[model samples]
Target chain A: MYGTNPFRELEALRREVDRLFEGVASPSKLRSAFLPGRSARSYPLINIQESGDDLTVEALAPGVDPASLEVAIEGGSLVIAGEKPRPAQNVSPEAWHRSERAAGRFLRKIKLSVPVDEENVTADYRNGVLTVKLQKADAAKPRRIAVNVA
Target chain B: MAENTVQKTNGSTAVVATETEATREPERFVTPPVDIYETAEGLTVVADLPGADPSAVDVNVEDSVLTLKAVVPEADESEAAYVEFRLASYFRQFTLGEKIDQERINAEYKNGVLTLLLPFAEKAKPRRITVKAA
Candidate 1:
C-alpha cells in the first residue's frame, strides 16, 4: 500500500514552514502576489534528476491513489490532477475535541523547458511518490563522433 | 463493553470498544474514531481528541462549513527531542453539506475529545409526515 516515510513527512513540514514564512516575510509583496481569483494551490515538491538517457521527476503525493491521479504531458507542461476524498465520519456524541485532516481536490502543473519523447514516457507510483521518466527523443540524443584526421 | 485504548505519542490517545480489533494492529496513520448522528434538533458530531485541552482547541461553523483546529502542547522549542511518533498539532476542515445549520452549532472539549453539535436549519433536516387515508 502507498505510504509516507519520516523523511517525506519532514519535507512536508519544511515546505509548510517555508510557505508560512514566505507569506509573513513580505506583507506588501505577498498581498500583490496573492491577489484574489489567483490560484491558491501549491505545487508538489518534485525532485528532478538526469541519468544517462532519461530525465526523472518524482512528486510526493501522500494518501492519493495512483488510479485517481491523472498525469499527462501536454504542450511542454506536465499536469497532475487528483482528488482525495474525506474519510468517512464516525464521531460519537460524547467525544470532545477534534483535529481536521486535509482532504480535497488538487491539481499541479509543471512546465518542462526541454522537449522530451512523449511516446516513451513512463510513470510509477510507489511509497506515496510518483516518479515519471521522460526519455530524450532520438534527435536530442548526443551523437558519438569517431576520431578522424587526428 | 470494555474500553480498548491505544497509546499514541504526543499524549494522543484513542479508545474504542474492546471488541473492535481494528485498533489493535500496528498503528499506521489510519482513520481515527469519530461519529456523526442526526437528530430532530440538529446534527451532533463526536470526535476523539485525546490529551487535548479545551483552551487549546477551536471549532467553528460558517455557511455550511465546519472548521476544527487545535494545538497539542509540545515541549518548549529548546527542549531536547525525546521521540516523535505522530505529527504535532491538528487541523481538520469540512465544507458541510446544505443540511448543516450554520448559526447554532455547539461544541464541547473534554476527556481529550471534541464534540460538535451542528443544528440544522428547520427545513434542512429530514421530516416524516403521516398522510391521512384518501
Candidate 2:
C-alpha cells in the first residue's frame, strides 16, 4: 500500500529492469565470444584491466588450494591453472543436502595484446580472489610524443 | 522436538540486511553458491563469497531463518580499459525447521567461504530402548 503511486511504481519497475541488463550490455570479453552456452564458459572468470604501466588480472577462484595454483607466462599468453577441491571431501554422499557449488581443476590461457616484462610479474591470492600484476615491456609502453615548430 | 531441516527461503531471497540497505544506493548483489551436508551430529553449509573480507561477512539466524550477507570494498573501475565481472555484495538465505538445534549453531569462515554447523538437538536424535525378558 505504501508504494501505491502509479508513476513512482513504474519508475522503480523500470529501474529494476534496466539494472538486470546493465552490466550485461557492456562489450563481451574477447575470449568468450565464440564460447557456447553459459556452462561452456571457462571456470573462474577473470577481468583484465590496463593502467599506464601495468596490466592487472583478477580471477574469481574461491577455495582454491594455494599449493595447487600455477601462474605462468608462455610467449605472449598468460596461463592460469589451479584446482578447486570440494569444500567437504570427507562428507558421505548420502548425507548431502545440496551441492550447488562447482569444484574441480581449471586452466585458462589469455593472449595478451601487448608484450609484458616477464621478470617483474607478481601474483597473490586473498579473500578467494587472485590478483596478478604484470609490468608492460618497455617497448610496448605508451611513449610521450613532442611536436616541434621551427 | 525440532528436526532441523533446512530450506532455501526463496528462489534466492532470505535477506535480513539493514546494514546493506544503509549503504549507498543502486548496489547490486550476486547470489553466492552453496553446499549443504548432514552428519550424525548436525548439518554443515558452505558458501562461496569471493572478494569480500572475512571481517565484512555477516551471518544471522532468527525466527528459524538463516541469512548470509558479505560486503566487498568498492573498487574504482571507471578507468578500467577492459572489464569482466564486477565486485558486488553476496546475499542468500535459508529457512531452518525444527530438525536443527538452533542453540548450538556454529560458523566458520576461510578463503572466502562460510561454513555453518547446525547441530541436531538431543530430542531429535534417534534413541534406542532396552527390553528385558523375565
Candidate 3:
C-alpha cells in the first residue's frame, strides 16, 4: 500500500477550495516548458564490472573512432574524452515536425575504490563499442585464510 | 573434412571463400543499447542512438522517475544494402531512489551517444566515520 505525502495532500485540498471559490482558477501545469540552450553538465555512460583480477569499464561510444578517444587514470579517477562526428543523411531539405538526436563532444569521469594499474590497462574498440579493462592493485585483491579451532 | 582447391591464372587473384551462418537478425522492436556506470557522485547512463539529433531526444523526470525517448530515422528507400544492424528508437524510463537528486540531473547528446548525469542527493550520499574508543 502507498500513501500520499501529507504536505502535498494538504496542498491539493487547498487547490480544490481555491478552484471552487475562485471564478477563474488555473490548474498548475505538470510538464516543464521547453527551453533552448539550458545549462547542463556532461556525463558519459559506462558499464563497469569486476573480474578475477581486472575491473572492466565499458563506455558505449558508438560513432566515435578509438583514435580520437583519450583514456587516462589520475589518482583514483578514470576519465574518458572523445568527440563524435555526425553522419550524412540523404533526406530531402524540408521541414520536419520533430528531430531528436544528440551529437558532439562527451567526457566521462569515474572514481574507483580499488586503485588500477595504469600501465597494464587496456582499451579496445570494436563494432562501435569501447571496452576498457583495468587491472586491480594487489592490495585490493581478496585473500583467504584457514581458521584453526582450539 | 571439406578441403577446397583454388587456382589462379592470367595474373588474376583467386578468391577463397567459406560459408558461415547468417548474422543474427535485428530485434523486432527497436531498442537502443545503454551503458550504465556507478560513480562516486551517483550514476551515469549512456545510450546509443545513431542518426538521432538532440532535438529528437526527450528526457523527462516525474515523481522520481526518469525517462528517455528518441526516434531513429528510417533508412533511405532508394539505396540497397547487403546488411544493416541499426534499429528504431522508442522510450526507456527508470524509477530512481532517494539517492538521485532530481533537481540537479543533467544530460547531453552528441554524435549518437546520450549521456545522463545523475548526482546523488546530499543527504543520501555515503560518508565514512572514524571509530571511537569507549
Candidate 4:
C-alpha cells in the first residue's frame, strides 16, 4: 500500500506532458485540448488609469456586441462579461482557411485599488473598446496638510 | 498571439532617426488577432484592433504587401495605478497573392474590428463548365 501507484504516476506524466505542450502549442489548440469551456487566459486585456479624481478602465473587446456587454461592480471587483458571435454564416466550418479568432462568452474580474463612487460610474463603448470611468470617493482623494510654524 | 516582427532600420543615419522616433512611440503593443477565411467569391480578413480610433487607422496595399497601422491615444502615464493591458499602437502586414483583385478590394471598420474583402480576380473565380454531348 505504501508503494508508488502506477495510475498516479501516469497521471503525473500526463500533467507534465500538458505543461510541456503549453509552451509550444497555439492558444486555440491548447484551449480546445485542456480548457474546454474556460475563457482564454488573458483575453480582453484591460488597462486601468487614475487621474486627479477619477479612474478609467479600458477594455479591449473586439467583435463583441455592445448590447450584450455587461459591466458591474461587486464589492471591490469590477466584472466584465460578454459574448462574441461567430463570424461565418451559412458556410460550413471546413470552408475556413485560417480560423485564428475564437468566439465565445468571456468573463473577467479586476480588483480596484481605490474606493469609488458607485453612483457616478459611467461606461462607454467605442471602436470595440469599452471605457469605464469611476469617480474616486472623497476619502480616497489625496489630502494636503499645511505645517504650522510656532 | 501572432508574431508581428519589428521593422528593421538600416544605415547609421536611419538608426539615429529611429532612436529619436522610438522615444515618441508607445512602450509596447499587442498583436491583434486576425481570422482569414476563404469563400466562393474571395477572401475575407478580420482583425481586432481595440482602443484604436477609426480615423487614425491606415490600411495600405503596395506591391502585393498589405499593411495595417493604427495609433492608440496615449494616456497619462503618471496616473497608472493598475494595468493588466499595455497601451500601445498596432501594426501588421501580410503578403497578398496574385488571385486577389487589389484594385477592387473593399474594407470596413467598426466596433474596433477591421474587415477587408479581397475579391478574387475574374479569371481566378471558379466557373461551371457546360458539358457538351459528344
Candidate 5:
C-alpha cells in the first residue's frame, strides 16, 4: 500500500488547473510562486540611470555578502557577479513552512550604449543594494551649444 | 431642511477625514518575499527588503497581528535608462498565534534582509514529565 492514492491524484490535478489559471491572471506573481527555491528570471533586479557625466547602476540583492560581490568593466559591457549565501542555521527541510528566497552564484552582463571611463568607476554596497557609478568618457558627455543673437 | 442636510454632509466629511488621516496611506509598497521556518526553540522569519534603510525599518506586534514596514528612498526615474523591478517601500503583515512570545521577539536587518526570531511562549514550549516507579 505504499503507492499513490486516488484522492491525492485528483487533488494534484486540481492544483495544476488552479496554477494554470493563476499564471494567466498574474504572470509575475505566478512565476515567483512556481519557483520556490530559485529565481524565476534573474538573480538580482537592476536599474540603470545616466546623469550628466556618470552612469549609475543599482542592483537589488538581499542576503548577499559584500565581499563576495565583484564588478568589472569588460570591453563595452559592465559585469556583475556575486554569490548569495543560504541561511547559516541548519534546519531540516521538513521544518520549513516556506522557502521563497533563492541563493546561489549569479553573473550578469550589461552592455553600455556609450563609452565609459573604466578607470574611474566606483562601487558601493549599502542596505543590500549595490551601486556602481561609471564616469562617462569626456566625449560622451552632452555639450551645451551657445548661439549668438541675430 | 437645507440646514440639516448641510450639517449631515459636514459630519460625514469630518469622519472621512479622520479615517484617512489615521491610516496615512502610502503611495506605493511591495510585498517582500519571506521564508518561515520552525525550530525546536521557536519560529524564524526571514524577509528580503532591498534598498531599505535599517534605521527606517519598523516591526510592531499588536493584538496578535505582526506588522512590518520599511521606507525606501526614491530614485530619479527621469534619468533611468533601464528598469526591471518596481521601486517601492516594503510593507507586509502576519497574524501571530498565542503560542508565540510577543515580548521576546528579536529582529535584525543586514544586507537588505530582515530576520526575526519568534520564540515560543513558556506554556507552549515542549516539556517532559518524570514518571516515578510504582
Candidate 6:
C-alpha cells in the first residue's frame, strides 16, 4: 500500500531504477540484494524508511532463529546477522522434492543516509521479518534563515 | 506412476515460471520463499511470509491443489522517506503428489513462517518385505 506522499514515491521509484541497473552497471560485482540464490553477502533484502524522527529498517528474512538473530547499530551503519536452519536436516540427500529457500548464516551491513542515535534503537522480529527503529541523531534544521547586514 | 510437475516461482534466480492462476487475483501478492523436502514419513514445506498475522494466514487443499495464502498488514513503509521492500500478501500453490495423504495433512504457522506436513498415504509409504528361503 502506498501513501499520499508523492516525494517518497518518486524516491522509491528512483531507487528501484537504480537497483535494476546495478546488474548491468557491474555484472560481476552486484549480487542479489533481497532474495537469496548464490548469495554471498546480500542475504536479507532490506527496506529503510524515514517516518517522522525515527528511521525504520526492515529485513525480509524468515525462519531465522530468534536466538541467533542480532542487530547492531554503529553510527550510520546497521548490521544484521542471523542463521537460518534447514527445515529437514535429517532427511537423506535424495528425499528433497524442492529446496528453493536458502539456508545458513547471513550477515548484512547497510550504510544509512542519515545519522541515527544508536542508544535509541529498538529491534523486533515477527512473521519472519526484522524491523529496527532508530532515532535520528540530529534534528533537521529549518530551511529559512534571516540575514542581517552589519 | 507419473508424478506431478512441481513448477516453481523464482523471483530470486530469475528463472520465472509462467503462472496462470497466481496472477488471477486482483489483489497484489508476493510469492513467499519456500523450502520443500521429503522424508520417510512425508513432505515438509517451510515458507517465509513476514508481517502476516497468524490468525489471518490460510492454508487449504482442494481438488489435489494445495494453496497457501496469508493476509499481511502494511508496515511503516506507507509514507516512508525511503523504501526498499514493500509489504504485500503472500500467495503460492502446489499440486499434491500421488503419494500424499490428503486426509492427514497438517499445517502450522510461527513467527511469519508456515510449515506444512503432507504425509504419504499408508499404502504409499516405503515398506520392506521379508524373503523366505525354502
The candidate maximizing DockQ is 6
For all the predictions, what are the DockQ values? 0.05, 0.35, 0.04, 0.31, 0.30, 0.46
| Model 6 stretches astray by more than 4 angstroms | A1-34, A39-41, A138-150, B1-19, B74-78
Q: Estimate each model's TM-score.
A: 0.38, 0.77, 0.40, 0.72, 0.76, 0.75
| DockQ metric, candidate 5 | 0.30
Clash pairs, candidate 5, are none
Candidate 3 chain A has its poorest 10 consecutive residues by lDDT at: A28-37
TM-score for predicted model 6 compared with the true structure: 0.75
TM-score: model 2 vs. ground truth: 0.77
Q: Model 4, residue B70: displacement in angstroms? A: 1.8
Tell me the deviation in Å of residue A38 in model 5.
Answer: 3.5
lDDT of 5 by residue, B1-134 (tens): 10111111211211000011235365555567777777767778888888889998999987776878898777769999887655567776676666778999999999888999988888877788999999
Put down candidate 1 lDDT per residue, B1-134, tens digits, no spaces. 22334333223322212332343333312122354545455555655443345677778765544656666554233322221122234454555555555777778764344667777677755567999999
lDDT of each: 0.54, 0.75, 0.57, 0.71, 0.75, 0.73
Q: What order do candidates take by DockQ, descending?
A: 6, 2, 4, 5, 1, 3
Q: Which ten residues in a row have the lowest lDDT in candidate 1 chain A?
A: A29-38
lDDT of 3 at A3: 52
Candidate 2 vs candidate 3, TM-score winner: 2
- Interface C-alpha root-mean-square deviation, candidates in order: 15.1, 5.4, 20.5, 7.8, 10.7, 4.3
- Candidate 6 C-alpha lDDT tens digits along A1-150: 997999999999999999998746542231133257455546787777776677888887888899999899865689999998878768776556566677889898999887777788899998788989888776542245789999
Candidate 2 lDDT: 0.75
Per TM-score, the best of the predicted structures is 2
Taking chain A of candidate 4, what TM-score results?
0.69
Better of 3 and 4 by TM-score: 4
Q: How far out, in Å, is residue B86 in model 4?
A: 1.6
Q: In candidate 1 chain B, where is summed lDDT lowest over 10 consecutive residues?
A: B79-88
Backbone clashes under 3 angstroms, per model: 15, 8, 14, 2, 0, 2
| Tens-digit lDDT track of model 3 for A1-150 | 335798987888899989786533211110000110122523344557675677877665566855789889988999898876533233222211112234467777888878877798888765345668888888887677889999
